[model samples]
Target: MGIFIRILGAFVLLSATYNPTRWNFTRWAEANWGTQMPLTLLFGLLLGVGYLIYIGATLRSIGAFGIVLVAAIVGALVWVLIDYQILTLQNPSVNLWLGIIAL
Candidate 1:
């Protein structure tokens, strides 16, 4: 449940900020700032920091490397299930690899 909350928080942050097909907080930032790069970097930093904090707080039992490994496994599994079964994407291998690395 803790891990799920962390992941869900990250996902909500991401979708709120920069979902490709959505009007989001990032768009508002870009519109006001007249630039996208700095906002992008800021949000990315926030996301990374938030994830680290969550992991440290809730995943200490697993340690750093174990947390990363578990995240990679979960990311890969989700990618496979969604891309293959739900989306039926034509080429999901790249997404699977990227998801593992990202998580």
Candidate 2:
């Protein structure tokens, strides 16, 4: 229950500043001289790694009964810190709110 709230809040907060251009990271390939194919593959690989990190973090939070709320809290904080550079009042407002709720 609490984990759901934290995730929802994080998504709502992070999506506000999210830029799709970040996803189009393969533009670097065009400048590299015929490396477009490999660049696209690399982009895909990076996205996969991000997803794997997310999954691993979530899985680690699970305990004998269910998801540990504090684990989710820590994971969310680490995620926002690493992924979006969001740690202060400038970003992740909803995450801050979620943290309050979790507490």
Candidate 3:
């Protein structure tokens, strides 16, 4: 449950920032910039806080090297899938989602 919660949180943070669905903070802020600057800034700051907390804990837990190691492993697995024709980089949206999930 704990692990699941952490994963969920990371997903939320990433999704909130930018996702394949094309609805996220950047778009929201851009659309409302002229009319809702305050609200947009508020949400942007909140999202920044979320990123700080997540990134701080992540670095403290694993450090940069660990992060790279994990990424390399995942990249390798992704490469294998591509080799096996399970994943294709031809679709940019899929690649973007994979990159987001990988992060």
Candidate 4:
């Protein structure tokens, strides 16, 4: 159950970070604030901090190695799903890979 929650959390985090139709900060900034490097940096920092917090909490509950193992499983699952067209992505980029690894 704990591991399941972790997996679900990882999926949610990845979606929030990478899904353009969802909570994609980069897309939002580009549309509203224009394509500026400073805004990109700011959004990146915010996302990075959020990722750290989420990872820290997961690590606290699962330990370092366990977290890594979980991340690997989640990443592989995501990659396979995307590759097989189980998950539809309009423009999958490095962020998708990073999000999977971060999960």
Best by TM-score: 3
Candidate 4: how many backbone clashes? 0
TM-score of every candidate? 0.43, 0.31, 0.83, 0.46
- Backbone clashes for every candidate come to 0, 0, 0, 0
Give me the displacement of residue 85 in model 3, in angstroms.
3.5
lDDT of 2 at 4: 88
Task: Give the per-residue lDDT digits (tens) of candidate 1, residues 43-85.
Answer: 6678778767866765667777887787788867777778767
What are the Cα lDDT values of the candidates? 0.65, 0.55, 0.89, 0.71
Model 2 backbone overlap count:
0
Winner of 1 and 3 under TM-score: 3
Q: Who is ahead in TM-score, 2 or 4?
A: 4
C-alpha lDDT of candidate 3 relative to the true structure = 0.89
* Model 2, runs deviating above 4 Å: 1-35, 63-103
Please give the range of 10 consecutive residues that has the lowest summed lDDT in model 1: 94-103
Point out the higher-scoring one by lDDT: 2 or 3.
3
lDDT by residue (tens digit), candidate 4, 1-103: 9878867777766675666364576566666675577867787787788788877887788899997787789878878977997767665665565555554
- lDDT for model 4, please: 0.71
Candidate closest to the true structure, highest lDDT: 3
